[model samples]
Structure formats: structure tokens, C-alpha cells
Target chain A: MACDLSPVLLSVRVALISTVLNMIMGTILAWVTENKRFPGKNLLETVIGLPLVLPPTVIGFGLLLLFGKHGPLGYFLAEFLHIRVVFTWWAAVIAAAVVSLPLMYKSAKTGFASIDKNLEQAARTLGSSETRVFFTVTLPLAAPGVIAGLLLSFTRALGEFGATLMLAGNIPGQTQTIPLAIYFASEAGDTRTAVFLVIVISFISFLITYGLNWWVDGRSSMRKGG
Target chain B: MLEVTVKKVLTDFTLEVDFTISDGILVLFGPSGAGKTTVLQSIAGLSIPDYGLIKLNNRIFFSAAQVINVPARLRRVGYVFQEYALFPHMTVKQNAMYGIKGCKDMDGRYKLSVLDVMEMLKITHLQDRYPVSLSGGEKQRVALARALMTEPDLLLLDEPLAALDDKTRRQLRGELKELQRRWQIPFIIVTHDRTELNYLADAALFLRNGKPYRVLNRNKEQPYD
Candidate 1:
């Protein structure tokens, strides 16, 4: 029997969209947290990093509560905008984004923190606006780490299961991703499809992680050589 | 002319200074932790003082009493950091051209061109090269060129020769003095090297414990050995 490619396609799409969202949100959050000082800054950082330690199911439960029909945000959306977020492909994207965000944020934060502050000050003295200084000097220098973060986020989003299951539900040709499809296939005793998805996910994750390691290593060696 | 009267409390000492500097090279000579760099930073608008004013060429750069504080980008001061602080990802040309894009003269024309400053610093051949491949001396020239691109009213160099070799340091010292004269702008240099202080400074301010101990005019004195 021919393999159904819809799961693979949907998984890739969800991962791609989630990775882009993660990159933007993570970069901004990392910059603000890393450079600015304010009261309760530590609390804000801890909240952003909560997903790293919290179970995916717990996160999914929290999201479900927040986005449920009677919940405050859910009420506003459903009442005003007439949008339903639960148990949809969009829910899959949101679940993957939430779970993968911490990886991107931490990596981007480390990247921004490692740069010399003097370089930014130098740009300021040269009459560069703060936005210009960040875009021109700070962002470019931190690119390698940011790229690695993006890769990790994509892989993490691709492999997400429990959160997607709780928030989006496993519906064929709709919210079903590779991991969820594998789970359902095995439950139905379709070992062939399950094994095939497992191999595909493993291969994809292996390539992404291997590329990240190679890039990080090349960057460090380039720095040392220079 | 630049007039500075400010006070800032550091962990080990308090920096309090009231001085006016006119044309020529003025050196802040002090030990490492004596707050020399802090003084330069204050003048460049990078650091805020507890109280007092900083006036450069009749422009109020900062005034705590009047609550007037010009941001660093509008201060029109060039700061060459000790390590040069060149942008590692950019070519020398890009770094030199950075400030030129934002600056304009009275007629609304761009004040200085990148090629002009690069040629002045003798780095014309190295414009396409990145900072990572440049020697310390080349990096210093690129930094100076980048700073000069803004057409600053004052130039500040923090430990300008600290990162260079002995021979290169000696060579750049004469070039630096010539640059100040040619540009006809006030240049404030911070350094702990006695030889550099004696050789390049038209006057030197001796600082100890974040206070100005004395001011010496080198016009009539022999060089310190």
C-alpha cells in the first residue's frame, strides 16, 4: 500500500509556521530581557522559560483553559471575531509554538549576551539610533546562535505530540502531525505506517541536530582562527 | 571649548571634576581604576553624572539642573574605544560609512564621505577587508576613520595605544598629534602610559582616587623619561 503523504506535509507546514513565529517572538523577548533592567525582570524571564521545565500536557491544559469557549480570551474571540481555536490546524501551530519557544529564547539570549557591550556603545557614539545599532551591529554578530535556535525550534515543533493531541486533537488530514499519526497508526495496529513515520521523524531530527552541531563548531573555529 | 562639571559615585571612589578644555590635545593620566574612562564616557554622553552640566562649543550636552540631557547619538562626539570596537561582521568601508549616512552640514549636504576619512587614515587599500583579518594598527586606523565619519566637534580616545605593539604605539603617537592639529578639534585622550602622556599631550591632567590631582602644561616642560 502507498504511504499517505498528508501527515508529513501537514507536519512540515505546522513546524515551518511555528518556527517563524518563534524566531520573531524569541528574538524580541531575548533582546528585551538581556539588555533592559526593570523590577520583576527575573519573574518575567522565569515565566517565558516555564515551558522548558513544564510538561507538555500541563502546557496543553493551560492553553485549553485559556482558549476554551467560555474562557475570557476564548469568549472575546468567539463572541467578537467568531474564531474557533480549539481542535484545529491553527491549534497545532500554537501548541508547537508554545512548546518550542523556550529553546529559541534561551539560545538567542545567550547569543546576545556573549557580544561585547562596548561595540554597541561604539555604534551609539558614531550617531546610530538604538534600533539601527541593534539591527546593524548586534543582530549580525549573534546570527549563528540564532540560526541554531531556529533549527532546534523547527525540530522540536516537528516532534511535538502531547500538546498537539490535547489542544488540536488528532484528526486525519486536519490536525494530525507525524508524531500523532504514528501514535494513532500503532494504536490501530498499523505497524507499517507507524514504523515509517518513526523513521522519517528520526531521520529529520538527526539531520537538523547534526547541522546545528556542525554550524556551531564551524563558528567557534572561525572565531578562534581569526 | 568644552566645559564639564559633574560628579558620579563609583564603588571605590567618587569622580568629581570641573574643567574647561580648549583646542589641542588634553590627556587624562591616571591609574587604571581612577575613573579616566568614566570621564570620557560622560563627555560622550554614554554615562550620566549625578549632577552638573557639560557644555561643548556653547551647546548644552547635558545639564542635570535644567534637566537637559542630549542622547549619545546627538552629542557629535567621536569615541575610539581601547580595543577599536570595530564591527566584526562588516567590512572596513561599511564601518567607516556608518555615521556618515546620518550626519549633515548646515547646507544639508553630507558632512564627510567615507572615502575621505579612509584616505585620511591611510586605510584606502583595506576598505573591503573585515576587522577579523586586520592587524591591531589597521584596526586602530579603521576605528579612527569610523569616528571621524561623524564630523564630531570633539574626539575622545580611551587608551588609544593600549592594544598595540611598542613600535606601532610609538608610530601612531605622532600621527595622532598631527591628526588633532589638522582637524583643529579638541582631542581628549585617556592613558596610563607616562611616555604617551609626555610625548603627545599639550597638557595633562593627573588624576588620583577619581580626583584631579594637578594639571600640567607641557609647553614649557621637558619630556618625562
Candidate 2:
């Protein structure tokens, strides 16, 4: 019998949406924290990095409280906006975004830090405005790091399973993702489907990792770009 | 004409300097830590003085009492840093044309001409090449081209030829003198090289340990203003 493909589609949708969120929110956080000096900077950095080390169940528990119909944001969202997020696809997206943000932030920060400061000063002396300099000089130089960040972020979001399972639940066509499908397929003795999904996910992971390695190797650090 | 009477306090010592220079090459001759670069930075509006006045051609660049400090971009001055400071990502042509595109023509005295500056500095052929691909002398010329393209009223060159070989250094010294004569702007060069002092300086002010020690003139009579 042909296996169900709904899990694959739902996984792709969640990963794509989460990756977009990671790009915008992660890069903005990196730029702000890297450039400015404000109070509680250390605290902010710790909070950003907390998801990297936190247990997925713990994160799910926190999300449950926050969006469980009567919780603060959940109450406001449900009452004012008529949206419920406790066990939905949007909750899966939020979980993936929160988990993958630190990687993107770290990568972008490294990219921005590797830039030679004198180049910025040179542009300034040449009469370019700060915004102009950022677009024309800063962003281009930091492209490699930013690209690396995006790739890593996308991969991390794709592999997200724990928080997603707890928050979105295995709702078949509505919220069943690849990892959840594989687990239930084997548990229910559906060996053929389980084997197929395992192979597919492993193959995709190998492709992403190999591509990332090759891309980074082609542009090693301190090698002058002409 | 430019007049500067500025005092800046550094960690090791205090910097108190006073001078008045006109349209000629004025060399700030000093040792390593004598705050020579600070003076150049102050004149270029990159550094703030503790207290004093920097007046150039009736425009107040900075004044402590009058509460004025013009930013670097609006100062109508060009600064060529010691390391040449060219945008590594940009080609020679882009670097040379950087300051003149968006900004208005500076004060209507010196025309904005990238072609003239590039042709005069002998960097016209290097328009498409990046900074890393260029040799030391080529980089220096590109830096000069970038600075001069703005047609600034004051050009600050910090150790312009210090990184070149002896032959290239000698060659650029002569070209710099020619460029200075043609530009006719106040060229304040910071250098410790005695040869540069004799060759390019129409006037020289020696600095020691963050203070203006003395002033030597080739044409003017008095030392201090």
C-alpha cells in the first residue's frame, strides 16, 4: 500500500514558515545586540541562547501555559483576535523558530564581527551615509556568514521533532509531521513506511550537510575576495 | 587658511597644539606616540578635543565655547589614513568616485573631477581592479585618488608613503609634491621621515610626547600664530 504523504507536506510548510521567521527575527536580534550597548545585555543574550539548551518538553510546557486559552498572551489572542494556538500548526512554527533562532543569531554575529572596521570608516570618510554604507559595504561582506546562518537555521528547523510533537500533537493530516509519522508507523508495526521515511530524511540531511560543507570550504576565512 | 588651537588629554599625557596654516604643505613631524594622528583626526572632525577652536576659512569646524562640532562628512575635508584605508570590496573606480556622487560640490572652489584626480595621480589605468590586487604604490595612488575626488578644502595624509619601498617612496614623494602644488589645498601630512620633511613640507611643526614642540618655516617668517 502507498504511504501517506501529508506528514511530508505539513513538515515542509512548518519548516519554511519557521525559517522565514528565523531570518528576520534572528538577523535583527544579531544586528541590534552586536552594535548597541544597553542595560541587561547579558541577560538578553542568555535568554536568546536558552532554547539551545532547554529540554523540548520544558519549552512545550512553557508554550502550553502561554497559549492555553486562559494564559496571558493566549487569553488576549483568543479574546481579542479569536485565534487559538495551543495544539496547532502555528504552534509548531513558533517552536521551530524559537529553537533555531540562536544558531542564526550566532552565525550572523560572527559574520558581522569578521568585517574589517577600517572599511566602514573608509566609506564614511568617502561621504557615504551610514545606511548606504551598510547596504553597499557591510551586507555584502557579511553575506557568507548570513548565508551559512540561513542554511543552518533551515536544517535545524527541518529536524525539529520534540517540541513539535508535544505542542502540535499527531493529528494525522492536520499536524502529523515526518518524525511523528515515522515513530507511530514503527510503533504500529508498519515497517515498510517507517523504513521509507527514515531513508528519505537521512538522504535529505546528507545533502544539506554536504552542500553546507562545500559552500563554506570554497570561501575560507581571511582569503581575500577579489 | 586654517587655524587650530586644540587640547586633548590622552591616557599617558596631555595634547596641546596650536598652529595656523595656509594653502601649502604643512608637515606634522613627530615620533611614534606624539599624538600626530590625533591632530589629523581632530582636523578631519573624527576626534573631539577637550576644549579649543578649529577655524578654517571663516567656518567654525569645532568650538568648545560656541558649542559647535561639525561632523566628519560635513567638514569638507579629506583624510587618507596610514594604512591607505581603501574599501577592499570596491574597485578602484568606485573607490575614487565615492565622495563626489551623492554630496554637493564642496564650497564651489575646487571642481569635483574623478578623471582629473585619477589621471594626475597615475591611477587612471587601475579603475576596475580591487585594492588587494594592487601593489603598495598602486594602493597609495588609489587612496589619494579617493581623497582628492571630493575636492576637499583640506587634505590630511597620514604617512602617505611609509609603507612603500625606497624606490616607490621616492617616486610617490615627487608625485605628491606635484599633486599638492596642483591641488593648492592645505595638505597636512603626518610623518617622522626626515626626507619627507625636506622634500614636501613648505612648513613643518614638530611634536613630542603630545605637545607641539616647535615650528620651522620655509617661507613664512614667524613660527607660532
Candidate 3:
């Protein structure tokens, strides 16, 4: 039988979109949490980091309560915006973004914090406004961390299974990403397709991790040489 | 018309200083932990004085009484840090030009072109180089170039030449004096090196124990040492 490639395409699409979302939202959140002082800062930090330690199934359950038809956000979206997120590919994207955010946030924050504050003060003495200083001096210096976050988040989003199954549902050719497809194929005793999907995922995961290591090694050596 | 009277409690001893200089280089000569850096910080608006006032020309930088504190960004103060806090990622040219705020005639605002400043500091050839590859002297010049580009009314240096070798330090001493004369701006240098005081000080504050024991100016014909 010809292998169904729909899951592969769907996984890539979901992972790509979610990674972009996570990068934008996560980096901004990291910068804010790192630089600013405000009330509930610790609470906000805990919430952002909760996804990493929490079970994926538990996250899906929480997401379900928020996105169910009669739920608060779901009700407003359906009535006002005419958009429904539950049990759809959109839900898969949301799940991936939420789950992978902490990796991005933590990495970006560490990168920003490692910089000497004097560099920023140097910029300030040059008449650089706070916003300009961030973009010019701060953000460029933190770029390696941001790129690492993007790569990690993409891989995490790609392999998302438990939460995707619960929130998006494994609809064939639509929301059936690689992990869900592999599970269903194995459950049905379709060993051939299951093995093929497993190898594909394993290779992708290996490549991502290897690429991350190579990048980090090269960057550190480059810094040392400079 | 620069005037300052600052007092702030530190970890060990209270830093109480009151001095004024209209022009020329004024050196704060003291040992480590003597609050020399703190005094420069206060003048640059980087640190606020607990009580007293700082004024340059007529602009009030900080005042505990009036409760007025102008932040460092708007204070028009040039500060050269000890370690030359140049942006490692940016080239010498970029760092040099980083301070040039909007001026159609950049010559008129800062009273010198960016290229001229780099040339005067003799770092024009190293424009494309990063700070990491630069020698101690080159890095110092880049820092001075960056600060001078901003056209600050008063310039503050915190052990600016401390990291340099003796030869470079001696060479820069004369250059700094010439620079002050050409720029015609008041300078406050924080250094304990008596050699620096003898070579560069038009006025000097000798601090022994967090208190300025003597304030000597050239017009008074008193020896700095």
C-alpha cells in the first residue's frame, strides 16, 4: 500500500506556524520579564514555566475547559468572532505554542541576562533611548539565545502528541500529525506504516538535536576567537 | 559654571563632597573605596545624591531639596568608563557614530564631524575592527570618540587610563589635556595616580577618608601633591 503522507504535511504545517507564534510571543515575554519590575512578576513567571513541568494531557484538559463550546473564551469567539478553535487544526497549533513557550522564554531570558549592564549604560550615554538601546545593543547580543529557542520550540511542537490528540483530535488528512498517526497505525497492527513513521520522526528529532549542538559549539568558539 | 555639592551614605563610610569648577580638568585623587567613582556617577546622573545639588552651566542635574533629578540620557554628559564599555558586536565606526543624535549639520551640533572625531582620536583606521581585537589604547580612544560624539557639556572619566600600560597612559595624559583645551568643556577625572594629577589637574580634590581634605586650583598656586 502507498504510504499516506498527509500526516507528514500536516505536522510540518502545524509545527512551522506554532514555532513562529512561540518565537514572537515568547521573546517579547522574556524581555519584559527580564527588564521590568512589576507586581505578580513571580506569579507570571511561574505560569509561563508551568507548561514545561506539567503533563501534556493535563494541559489538554485545561485547554479543553477554556475552548469548549460553552466555555468563556469559546463562547465569546463563537458568538462575536465566529471562530471555533476546539477539535480543529487551530487547536493543535495553540497547544503546540503553549507547550513550547517556556523553552523559548527561559533561553531568551538567560541570553539577555548574561549581557553586562554597562553596555546598555554606554548606549544610554550616547543618547540612545531605552527602546533604541534594546534593539541596537540588547537584542542583537541576545540573538543566539533567541535562535536556540526557535529551534527547540519547533522540535517540541513537531512531536506534540498527547495534547494534540485531546484538543485537536486525530482527524485523517487534517489534524493527523506524525505522532498521532504512528499511534493509530500501531494500534491497528499496521506495523509497516508505524515503523516508517517512527523512523521519519526519529531522524527528524536526531537532526534537530544535532543541529542545535553544532550551532552552540560553533557560536561559543567564535566568541572565544573574537 | 559647573557646581556640585553631594552627600550619600555608602556601605562603609558616607561620601560627603562639595566642589565646583568652571573649566579645565579637575581630578578626584583618592585611593580605592574613596567614593571617587560614586562622585562621577552622581555628576553623570547615573547615581542620585541623597542630598545636595549638581548643576552644569545652568541646568540642574540633581537636587534633593527641589526634588529634581534629570536622568542620564537627557543630561548631555559624556562619560568614559574605566574598562571602555564598547559594544563588542559593533565595529569601531558604528560605536563611534552611535552617539550622533539627529543633526543635519553634525559638525555644528557636536562641533565636529564623526570622521574628524575618529581621526582626532587616531582610530579611523580601526573603524571596521571590533572592540575585542583592539588594544587597550585603541579601545580607550573608541570610548572617547563615542562619548565626544554626543557633544556633552561636561565629560567624566572614571579611571579611564588605569587599564593602560605606562607608556600609553603617559601618552594619553597629554592628549586628554589637549582634548579638553580644544573641546573647551569641563572634565572630572577619577584617579588616584599622582602622576596624572601632576600632569593634568587644573584643580584637584585630595580625599583621605571619604572627605575632601583639600580643594586646590591652579590659580591658587598650590601644588596638587
Best by lDDT: 1
Candidate 2 residues A1-226, lDDT tens each?
3477787778778888988888888877887888789999899999889889998778777877887877898999999999988688898888788888888889988888888776777676677777887887888888877888888887788778788877788788887778888998999999998888788777777898899998787666445453
Off by over 4 Å in 2: A221-226, B105-113, B219-225
- DockQ, Cα level, model 1: 0.74
Deviation from native of the Cα of residue A8 in model 2, angstroms: 2.7
**How far does residue A135 in candidate 1 sit from its true spot (Å)?**
0.9
Q: Tell me the lDDT of model 3 at B82.
A: 86
Q: Kindly give the stretch of ten consecutive residues in candidate 1 chain A with the minimal lDDT sum.
A: A1-10
Q: Which stretches of candidate 3 lie over 4 Å from their true place?
A: B65-67, B102-111, B207-210, B219-225
Tens-digit lDDT string for candidate 1 (B114-154): 77888889999999988999999999999999998888999
| Chain A TM value for model 3 | 0.96
What value of lDDT does candidate 3 attain over all alpha carbons? 0.89
Real contacts recovered, all predictions = 0.82, 0.52, 0.66
CA lDDT, every model vs. true structure = 0.91, 0.85, 0.89
Best by TM-score: 1
Clashing residue pairs, candidate 3?
none
- Of the pair 1 and 2, which is ahead by TM-score? 1
DockQ of each two-chain model: 0.74, 0.57, 0.57
